[model samples]
Target: MNSGRLTNFLIPLLAVLLGVIAGSIVMVISGYDPIAGYSALLYGAFGDSYYIGETIRQMTPYILSGLAVAFAFRTGLFNIGVEGQLIVGWLAAVWVGVAFELPKFIHLPLAILAAALAGALWALIPGFLKARFKVHEVIVTIMMNYIALHVTNAIIRFVLSDKSYKSEEIHESASLRSEFLQSITDYSTLHYGIIIALIAAVIMWFLLEKTTKGYELRAVGFNQHASHYAGMNVSNNIVLAMVISGAFAGVAGAMEGLGTFANISVKAGFTGVGFDGIAVALLGGNNAFGIILSALLFGALKVGALEMPSSAGVPTELVDIVIALIIFFVASSYLIRLLLTRVKKEGK
Candidate 1:
């Protein structure tokens, strides 16, 4: 890689290393063996085919959600409402899946499309508000999260559910589960959603890096006044960016509803996946391939953490501490850059 690319890669890598070190310190302070804890964690995530399958399954949504946050970041929009978008998308996808009867090809795509459109429409509200009324997206998105949660819950209870806390299971035709994958992975929940997530990543990369519209969006992000003066429609680009970001988040919800769960439950609280996406995007440096790798790391950490208490006599919560430390280091990257600069100067 070139110098710039190398630096970009090194920053996050070093942050991860530092976070690991800090976590080990915390484990020691807590009277646990960090080595054993981490070993168990790793084994739980990748030591067996079953674990590997689960890790990949967990990674699917992380990839899409990371893409959602990263897309908005690229366009100078803070889409804190990905959680809301994902919730509504999940509801829409499950509603379509349960309410429809069609061939697999048609049914599946239609459900996924419903999710995307739901997310897009939900996001359009904040986008429009920001574009037309100069409202800050952050406040609107945060409130929208609560709205999405309650609205989805109400929909499940009153409209989609048979007086239950969850919607009916989706039809088989709308499912993303693959028998071949299940058999190979010891019947884990891994599904074809990974393929969709990968494809979405590619699309984001192409849309943001290799297109005229992408350039215009980036330019608006860099300087909206300049972009407007240069004859770009700044307001429209803002709305488009949020819509696309919401679509990615919506697909993330579909990965959960159609692939992992096959139904939508009335949530008592947020799923946390959307919030975690912010950390994923930050750790990934908002790059497409970087987000994939970052999501993989997070997925493994989460899956592996489940084994810590059982195998190493460590609390599962330690993993959360480690993850927080990692994000802290990533967020403090300015210090890391300074350290790198010092090292280079000393070497020279």
Candidate 2:
């Protein structure tokens, strides 16, 4: 890699390293063996097929959610509504998966597409208001989240036959199950959804780097006034960017509802994948390839945390603390850069 590329990668890598080291210190101070805790963490995340499968299952939605947040960040938008978008999308996908009967291929795709559409529609209201009325998107999106929650709850109660907060199991045809793979992984729910997530990431990268539409969207993001002066439709681009971002978030919901969870439950307030996406995007520097690694790290961290309390006698909340430290370090990268520069000068 060139110097600039190397430097960019080094920033986050160093941040993560420092965060891990600090976490180790915390473990030591707490009277736990830091080495043992870390060893257990690694073993829990990658030591067995079951653990690996679970890691992948968790990573699947993370990839999509990371893309969702990353894409919006690229367009200079802070999309805080990913949580609501994902929840509603999950509800829509699960409803369609259970309500429909068709060929497996067709049914599955339809359900996923419905979820994407639902997410896009949810984002559109804020996008439209922001574009047309000059409303602040952040506020509108936050409010939409609550609206999505209550609206979905009411729909589940009155419209669906099932009075339970949960929807019925999706038709087998629409489910993204792989019996052969599941057998190999001891019935872990990792399926074809990983492939879908990868494909979406590739498409997103291509869309951002090699398309006129992407250029227009980014131009508007950089400066709406300049873009408008240049004869570009800034308002339209802003709306379109949010719509596409929401579509990505929606697919994340579909992955969980159709591939991971057999059904959707209204009582399940939020999966938090959308919120996690923000951290993923930030840690990854909003790059497509970076997002993959970031998502994997987070997925492993979560899975490892589940094993920590039982095996290492460390609280699972330690993982959150580590993540927070990592984020803090990343956010203050200038400090790290300055220190590195001072060390280099001293050596010189």
Candidate 3:
């Protein structure tokens, strides 16, 4: 590969290696066996069909959430409000699933569509503010997360559930759960959401790499003033970017509601999936295929962490620390790149 591509690939790999090393150090200091811990983790995540199925299930949402963040990054927008968009999308999806009854073909797509629209509308607030008023998106999205949490919770209690903590179970027609997938994977919660996630990835790749509008979005991201001078509609592009980003996040929520849980519950706090998407996007270099790989790595780590406590006598929380370290290294990749450049110069 060319030097640029090589560097792009090496950065995330190096970050993962450093994070693993750092995690091993922590394990040793904590009186745990790092090899045993990691072995158990691997076995837990991929030892059998069941674990593999579960890992794929977990990866479903991670992929979409990563896409959500990556898409906004490509368009010069920081969509920190993915969490809020996801929550509203989840609520909207579940409401449609519960409130409607129709053929499987229509009901399922309708619910998913509702989720995408809800997320788009939620994201539109900050997008419009950024485009029209020149307001910063970071602050608005952060506040909107809290708004989504409480508002969804209240709606579930009063409107959807008749003062219950969760909404009614969705109709079978609206479910994404697949009997064939479940049976093949030893009845694991694997669903058809993975298909949607993969399709979304392809869509992002095509939109960002193959289309004229994609060129405009990336150009705007690189230099808005130049893009405007080139006759691009920078304002509309900004809003459109956020809308597309939110749509991705909303589908992520639908994976949970219509596939994993088959309903929505009152969440006391954020799901953290949206926040994790930020790290996923960063580690993936905001690339589509890279995001899928990173999401799988994260999914394996999470699923394997559950096995660590039982088999290796390690705390599952250690995996969280490792993830944090990975993100830290990724965020500090400028230093890593500088070091690599110096090494190359010295070698020459």
Best of the candidates, TM-score: 3
TM-score of each: 0.96, 0.93, 0.97
For lDDT, the strongest prediction is 1
Against the reference, the lDDT scores of all candidates come to 0.93, 0.84, 0.91
Alpha-carbon lDDT of model 1:
0.93
Q: Of the candidates numbered 1 and 2, which has the greater lDDT value?
A: 1
Q: For model 1, what is the error of residue 128's alpha carbon versus the real structure, in angstroms, after optimal superposition? A: 0.8
Tens digit per residue, CA lDDT, model 3, 83-155: 8888999999999999999999999999999999999999999999999999999999999999999999999
Ranking by lDDT: 1, 3, 2
Which regions of candidate 2 deviate over 4 angstroms? 327-348
Give the CA lDDT, 0 to 100, for residue 195 in model 3: 97
What digit string (tens of lDDT, one per residue) describes model 1 on residues 206-247?
A: 999999999999999999999999999999999999999999
| RMSD vs true structure, all candidates | 1.6, 2.3, 1.3
Estimate, for each residue in 1-348, the C-alpha lDDT of model 2 and write its tens digit. Answer: 985677778877887788788888888887888788878888888878888988988898899898988888888788889888987888889889988899997999999999899999888888888899989888998888888888888787666545777677899988987887788877887888888899999999999999999888888888888999999988888899899989988889899889888787675466678888887887777888988998898788778667777788887677567556665675566577778778768998
Candidate 2 TM-score, C-alpha based: 0.93
